[model samples]
Target: MLEELEDLFESSTIRPTFSYVHIILALYIFEKHPEGIGRYRLKENLLIGSGTARSLINKLSEIVDFIEVSGNNKRRGHVLTDKGLRFLKMLKKKIPLLEEGNTKALEEIIIQDKKLNAYICLVKNSADKLNSGIEQRDAAIKVNGSGATCLIFDGNDLKYPKSPNIQNNQVKIGYDLQKYFKLKATEHNTELDKDDVIIVGLGDTSERARLATLNSALTLIE
Candidate 1:
């Protein structure tokens, strides 16, 4: 655990004295970036000299699950294997590690300290409200002065009732929308907070496109 923690803190652009820390961080990042980060990117980000990086990577390939993937322009790069995945899981502990001076850390603080409940609802027609300078709307079925209602995808209303922990965790959904909406590049533009219920991808009325909207709602509500 300490080795993983130490690797997390090493500057991505600086070469630490220890080469093993570089390998540890690189593997974790490869797991996160499955498409394979480019060789130049790895060199620039991991700060390993070309010759040493090649030799060390070859050595690593002998003992662990490592592969190279080529992308457009045909530059091949490193990614981890199923064996590496199992190894990472063995190394990883259940405890969450919060990074300082970042939004995720701030979010962790909100969940751990402030006891706030955040819910996101995929909404249409909210733009009109925003354009008219009505930024906040309550959960109701209509665009009334007091409240509004909308359909949620996963067999639930887009209503976050007033209760501690939102009916004790029944109201919360944990679908990883980032992975689900991967092909929709524009869907990822929103700024995320730890407790933020981000409702985005508004104004598209196509049936399938709207299904994606429903997916966002369902993912959160399920």
Candidate 2:
């Protein structure tokens, strides 16, 4: 993926030094862990000396709106956005898989109890809305609210379903969920042990739905 991205960068005709740095850092962290590379960790892994990862992060932040950094010290960490994930997917197709040691960094992020709670809230509504929108393509339905929803399906029981025709708005949300979860429509429906899966709903309003989902999921994790 990194090699492919390097090729893309080279082909783009932009010769900015920071552009290469940003792409390399983004791909490195992303390839290492699809969830994202936090700022401090990225700095450590990249062996970037002198200037903080913040500079590179700030640059990449302009192009990829989905990379998130948080912490009181401003050294917390970062994660990929749905947009960032799509970027990685594009590169993955072109690059031969590079073998590396099994550090399990990215896997740790998603599987962590606390982080999983965050992801449940962050991803659930988008995922539900996406699925609901797809369902609407087959049967008439209206997406009347901005809030997200959650549903559980048996992973093993879920058979691959056809992709439903989607409207422009629905398509964007659906694509985001698909990219975020790294799963296809059929795969999304597959069931897992309750202990192994957590789902949450992000509703339309920050006050009512989204926050509530976050709190609920956090409680579950706690």
Candidate 3:
């Protein structure tokens, strides 16, 4: 299903700077702002160029009919259609949660000169897909992320899939994540299950961090 979403962004003549995560975020933005948002505001939220934002909306409107324009050029805005709502529902089933995180909790693991914005996402039932966590990190990096960390919840605690020796710090990281992320019993009304994967994406800006996090999470989605 995600691949189908990716297909919507694929082009033969030119490559798109934005990704499917951007599309998902755009839908989320519209859902949050029912009054609708203009292309410039959406572009600021997405941290992309005006042309790219226009292209993203054009493709979504013409190809999938998932969105419709509300106002004219001076204050043109967009709102999702019924089909887009259904599509977002489907995505939620796989990726139940996505949120910003406090990087202070991650300082021990991700040491850097500059402070970074982090976005965390919970991908359901995908722990078995992880090995050394390199795959998830690489996915985030490909999308211009500073880096990413992958952890798995084993019904009791969240731990790095490959690093078990640092149990003490791992426990602290997990606790801080749960505390700061303020995870719900079920974000989409789906309970947190054992073997659920958690991905933290780091970037210089919130938009980049979010896209990076979602990109990392998608690698674990089946």
Candidate 4:
């Protein structure tokens, strides 16, 4: 799945430093800001340089035609095409939940760096693919995140993949997850499955945190 997504950015005429994370983020940005966003604002939201942004926009338009220009000149911006909206819909079906989280509440029970921002996402039915969670952590780190913690919700409790001692803080973590995360999931009309997995991404900035969170969650998908 990861390699398939990465292929979308491939271009014979131009070499792009961007990855699938950037593409997913652009789709998300288009969805959130339907009013249209200029290149500068898009670059700011993506945290990428001018060249990378140009190349990325080109790929999004020329390669996949997911986005089209809106307005004109300085007012020019991008908006998701019907194809892009449908693609985003498919992505959301796989990853139903992705949002920023306040992990400070679980600091006492979960090991978290208070200085970093935290993002939480729920990937439906991906728990079976989770190992010791090292892969998720590595995925986050690849995107400049501090780290990621993967947890699976069985019928009863949320537990670490291979940590027997997880019961020590299992109750507390579950309570906090529901209080801070699950409520948001409910609002989206997406009920999390008992066997779904949750990933918490910790990063220096909010954008990095979100990007890392999605990247880690993607690993659990297939």
Candidate 5:
């Protein structure tokens, strides 16, 4: 399969950057249509430039075992090998660990730096007592298409949105992240279970939501 993929890449023209986003997106495209999807279709669905699509396909050839088969009208398309399926499953578990490590590293910088610490202080009071674990406490941040954000701790049907901006400033549907963070702490000294995962939403406004999410995340750190 790898040799076959190399031959295909050698025959193709477009090339893209090394992006996990593209790889994941391609996997998603392949998953949605089990029969297989064409290169043109991937480019169209992903809306990345031609070079990016080529690069993405090239990278996938290296990491995932995929193959070309007859798509609609006998056009060439791709599908996941069994190896690819297992790789994605392994990635699902490891991605969160990677994110946590990075988030913690950033948290350290925020706490140790004077300016960052002061910035966090500004909104800490606003996000008090706002956290409630979803059915499961182990979820990483999930956002949905309607702009809803949640850390689902229960059996609750949390629609994890495909992509969430999550920029401490953007507001999805109507989630009030700033106020949600303030809800975590009733009094300054109180401590909740370190395992607790709080969920926030995008509210009616952006500035307020951003402030709240940023503050709420800080409160969690504190």
Candidate 6:
């Protein structure tokens, strides 16, 4: 029993590097907008700050040929190359599994407004279908399966309860969302965060799209 306890403690002690989340988000963003030119807009839409979003783009540029910046630096954006797509396809084969600590972190960052519980439900349900073979017909279906819910508060329609808030000096929540959904960064969009919250139907369309692409890519691998 002592040995088992030691092993458990050792396993729990392993902290994930920020690069893991960054790479995952980069892949997702690349997949959704292979063109890459509209990354700035994508960042805002996804509720990610300009700095964090740019860093992810820069890191991805190193690994794959898909990322390209505009010439003047006046208008910055990214475009995915064939190689990038292939890389994302490869990543699709390995589904990401979040530990209990990660889940707790997610809970803390998410705004616990009126829609908090619904968002949790959506996440839980959608996670169930992560490994399911069926193609998701729509965002609503996907959210239901993932056990997450959307909430419209302060005029911002948060697709999932997970906010892009920073915690424990970790990567932003948007980056984590990209990993959980297994898509490139620009795929998902964000509205405004508001106070008058209401539990809306599941509506993570972009996230669903990313998952679908990942699923399709995984199938091609085997």
TM-score, every prediction: 0.35, 0.33, 0.83, 0.87, 0.37, 0.34
TM-score: model 1 vs. ground truth? 0.35
For model 2, the stretches where C-alpha displacement exceeds 4 angstroms are 1-22, 34-36, 50-52, 70-75, 101-222
Evaluated at residue 155, the lDDT of candidate 3 is 81
Clashes by residue pair, model 4: none
Q: How accurate locally, in lDDT, is each candidate?
A: 0.36, 0.36, 0.77, 0.78, 0.37, 0.36
Candidate 2 lDDT over residue span 110-193, tens digit each: 222322212132222122333332332222112121222233322322111224554343211233343333342224353232
In model 2, state the lDDT of residue 55.
58
Show how many residue pairs clash in every candidate, following the order shown.
3, 11, 0, 0, 30, 35
Best by lDDT: 4
* Runs of candidate 5 exceeding 4 Å displacement: 1-18, 62-74, 92-222
Best candidate according to TM-score: 4
Candidate 1 regions exceeding 4 Å error are 1-18, 68-74, 94-100, 103-222
| Model 6 stretches with alpha carbons more than 4 Å out | 1-19, 63-66, 69-76, 95-222
Tell me the lDDT of candidate 1: 0.36
Off by over 4 Å in 3: 10-12, 71-76, 163-190
The per-prediction CA RMSD against the true structure, in angstroms, equals: 16.7, 18.2, 3.4, 2.8, 15.6, 17.0
Candidate 6: tens digits of C-alpha lDDT, residues 115-210? 322122111113222322233223334323232223222232233333346233222235454344322111323222232111122223433323
Displacement of residue 53 (Cα, Å) in model 1 is 1.8
Candidate 1, residues 84-148: lDDT per residue as tens digits?
Answer: 67655554321011011122322422233222222223332222222211123221111111211
Model 4 worst lDDT window (10 residues): 165-174
* TM-score comparison, 5 vs 6, better candidate: 5
In angstroms, give how far residue 58 of model 3 lies from its true place.
0.5
